[model samples]
Target: MKLEIAQSTPTAASIAMLVQEHYGLSEVVESEFLRRSFNQVYRLGLTDGRSLVARLSAERPRGAPNLQFEAAALEHWAEAGCRVSRCVPTAGGEIAIEVPLPEGPRALMLFEHLPGEFTGDTALDIEAFARGLAVLHTAGESYAGPESAYRLDLDYLLQRPLQGLLRAPTMTAELRPQFEELGERLQAAILALGELSQVLCHGDAHGSNNFIQIDAQARREAVFFDFDEAGPGCLAYELAVYPWNLHPRTVDGVLSDKAAQQWRHFISAYREARPVPDADLAAIPRFMAARQFWLLGEYAGRIPVWGSQAMPTDYLRRQVTMLRKWETLELPL
Candidate 1:
């Protein structure tokens, strides 16, 4: 999509006008609600055979200042014939339009709705998906927008280890001592691992952030979205989260042998696509611990698990247990 002269940031009236101007349609006869996060998305059906998505960013100034990066990324992918969304330019030849926000302005862009579904709960085509990831990771080297940097580190890990433990009323006296022991071991482990690992990483690669869908013939396809957390970090650190986070819920949240199996499978596939150095592999166990500690620290204290209809209780219990397990696992490095 080409950049065009900016309009007054979109309003309901402006969007209605914009859609008509671009699509040559008289009205938005119907809309299928899509997603509601920081931004609101809807699939708009037009009088013509074509359809388009309308994005209404939350009225916060500078919250979503532009969609330039997303447009560039998707356009680059599609131009390379990658299976991804194709950006559609508005009638005025602009890919994005600034919308009025309370503070300043938010930006909106429309994308050709791509096909896919959630990479279901288990046995997802991770191997195939890893191949796609390799393509993205390697191709992404040409990207110039956001500078990737390691966002999760040893200090960040240490700051939050005791969080969830402190919340569990059932946390026993023995567990308290265990937590202390875990903390010391983890501190040492992170220090040692830090000496060996660093790289451009996906700060968040948990399965939930990905989409897995089948085409008319039942062939599976994967698309990873939500790049907000993509930044600089240890590639090993990023990869370690895949297996543990893939669990539908965290009963103990510990890195069990079961979780390790998932890791082995996924990593084995990923390695085939792009071999990880032994030095990085040696540091992964400790990095996994740091990730768990980071999670417990960031959420357990503030986010309540009950009645939110979100993840199950056992899931969290498992996560806490996993953290303990991670604390004990020795890194190869």
Candidate 2:
């Protein structure tokens, strides 16, 4: 189902005009393209020696919280002294604004420039990163604002994605049964684990979504951002997400030994910072499988907005291969 249409970004001139008119950031000296998979992120430099990140959503991670809900979540984190991506509100005190597009309307958002640097090609301290996730989960317990209908549950994870694969025309006939069985097996496995430890999760706490800052004392700390996917979810599932982010750099016919060690270290650190239920630890592999399937469905579902570029032809097959390897994965926990 290649639609032959790729989403286009607005010109720098248009972006400047929109920023000035809406948020009063009139000194936009530069707007550089950062990335554009789920959203279009930009580095906006101002004449006043300030930097900000502007997110122009491509609008395809559907069925999560609305802009208002996310804004509240960020506000809560800020108020609680949790390091998160700070959202810049508009004159009307709103975090998200819609800009007219030829296709329809696209959502836009802005964030204060977080003061830190990312681990570009450096080995990440998996333990330090995990501690930050524990902190995020702890802070979520204190949120008094409106709760989102969304959660990282089966509906959002397995079932919805399974349905997306069903709609994909290119989904192989041979692989269809495999995915169906996999989905059923995953569902049963999740249920067999009984109740998992539940809390508000950062949803996507992978390396790219977090940054490390060094204070005047030269102590390094991790700060998380990209709460667009934040919601109620299992602690195990939250812990499992690290591997998926790591998969790209370390993927093979099997999960590499080094990567598995990193996964172990991260989980151990989470346990050190917060008590992880035994049930959640046992469920991590299944949750990893769930993440893979959900992302496959996500890419398939985004064909309307992003077209064929979203999923490579071999993508699903590779996921199937990864699933096979999951059987042999050995965790220290």
Candidate 3:
């Protein structure tokens, strides 16, 4: 059940207490905040000299389904020969501990710390992601798990966000019509994208989500973690995030020769597993646009915790610039 949540960041000290009390993890040698996005991640070192990663996920008014889906998804991925952070259960027989948020109670799940760090040059790792994504999509097709709380369908990705932005006080009248029209165009493109392949996607598949592990044999493996946003979605849109994330640092331009060359490698690697259809390629821009709008809506939703400064008053303007840049991108990647 959802309860009224107030805007507050869970402190490291308070989270450590929950870890000790609920998870039976005591004698914390050290604890430090890793980063905060959808979840507030912390690194905890123990007296036994073991380290664990704790995630305080009060980002949304989420419940059991969220954690359960993550557990199931991670297990599935791990079994399929990819490395994933396995979920740690609480001492009293729970997969997640309920930590109170200012607005409500949220589930906190501990994970085994995976070794290694994210690498800058991911040529081999990108290939791994491509192949791994194909395997994940296949496994997800036959998954018989309970219904997950997360879904990346058009409603979740586009329509809901479209409504949220319009409802937001931050949305200006000049921008309102533009967003509405853009939303309509994207929606139509999505519809015209008829029969696009669908599967469970690692909703955020950027570099930060995975790690580079070199085995004793000197073979490198790309280990993907964080199943928090994994859910069903169109394959093209899922694939689009790879380039979508690489765009901001675009040296030449989104469609420049340099950018195209960089994106082409990932797409080629992906085809080795399951090739993208011609129609899907044509719809990449629309999906990319959807991701931009969806993020804007997401920022609007997180306004209370992130505040106007963090999310900013000019968030819409930034998004417009972002979408325009994305539009300049070519479909033949």
Candidate 4:
């Protein structure tokens, strides 16, 4: 009988060989596995001391079409002068190369390695990160790429996560009703806000996705990467991700004054580049809650491959607690 594997990590030696063969990078001096989460990432070092990143998609519902959408969006954004990480074409001039793996066929794409550090929560860093996101939103207005297979809509953000959470074996029975009620409340509140501005969202615009570089003149620049979740979505959702991510970092489980001020700076910087409506600003809190659900669903759905330890009972409870805290917490926006 053939051994069934849910996922597999290709050795760095194999990756180096593959990159040399397909990408025509004859001077690859190092190939190292950087991370393995929703996808697998590898760092390839060239003899000239330059590096490139190789990302292999895991088995996802969106499949190759999603990658195609990302590649097209990246190309479009780069041409429009947005500081985004660019994808490297294969020797055959293809943006994505398909590789058969133990689980399934995964799409592999090489990218120009961005040289910078992840942005911190400092005011200047937050401002620069926010401005970069705004630039991306503005540039994406003219996107004429292939239609994405998915959207960050109510179904994808709320309903699917709710379903995944409820079906997870680790979910507590007592929390089931609470989860259902919260999901309904979130859906109702967001729907009552009427229509929101739709744009090509970074989908995962949290601070860590981009790298920040400061020049000798003290000018800050951010180069964004990881467009796996990029697609057409509500502008509010895109902006909410940063503040939503900040909530869990506070000591008191609420937005600290400093965090609130930083959020204000972020919004102000973004608005300086692009206009955001009052209604969209007001809808951010609701979308923040929706972000929590999206994350819960993401973890629950991946439990089979990631295993139970990744999403222990305590972690689920802590997430639920955070969600509850968000319901009563007031945001600066």
Most lDDT-accurate candidate = 4
Roughly what TM-score does model 2 have, to 2 decimal places? Answer: 0.90
Lowest summed lDDT window (length 10), candidate 4: 59-68
Best candidate (score: TM-score): 4
| lDDT scores of the candidates, listed in order | 0.57, 0.76, 0.73, 0.85
Residues 1-333 of candidate 4: C-alpha lDDT, one tens digit per residue: 998888888987788788888886658989999998888999999998889999988765333448778888999999999988888999988988888888777788899898889988788898899899988998999999898889999998999889888888888888788888888977888898889999999899889899999999999988899988899999999999998987763225767788888899899999998999988988899899998898888778677789877777777777666666666555775
Q: In lDDT terms, how accurate is model 1?
A: 0.57
Question: Which sections of candidate 4 miss by over 4 Å?
Answer: 61-65, 249-252
lDDT of 3 at 304: 71
- Ranking the candidates on lDDT from highest down gives 4, 2, 3, 1
Candidate 1 residue spans exceeding 4 A from truth: 1-29, 46-67, 86-95, 101-104, 121-124, 145-188, 194-204, 212-221, 248-251, 254-262, 282-325, 329-333
* Candidate 3 worst ten-residue window by lDDT: 249-258
lDDT of 2 by residue, 1-333 (tens): 644334667876577667877886667888777777777777888899988888887756455335776778888988888888878988787777888876667888988878667633333456667777888888889898877768789888889888887678667888888888878878887899899999888887766788887779866678877887888888877877887666552237445667767777777777888998889888887787788877878788788766665665577677676676764454555
Residue 194 local lDDT, model 4: 89
- Tens digit of per-residue lDDT, candidate 1, span 127-242: 55655565665555566654333245555455444655455554556556656676677777656644554543445666655667777887666666554344445667777677
The C-alpha TM-scores of every prediction are 0.61, 0.90, 0.88, 0.94
Error of 4 at 243 (Å): 0.8
- Model 3: how large is the Cα RMSD against the reference? 3.4
Ranking by TM-score: 4, 2, 3, 1
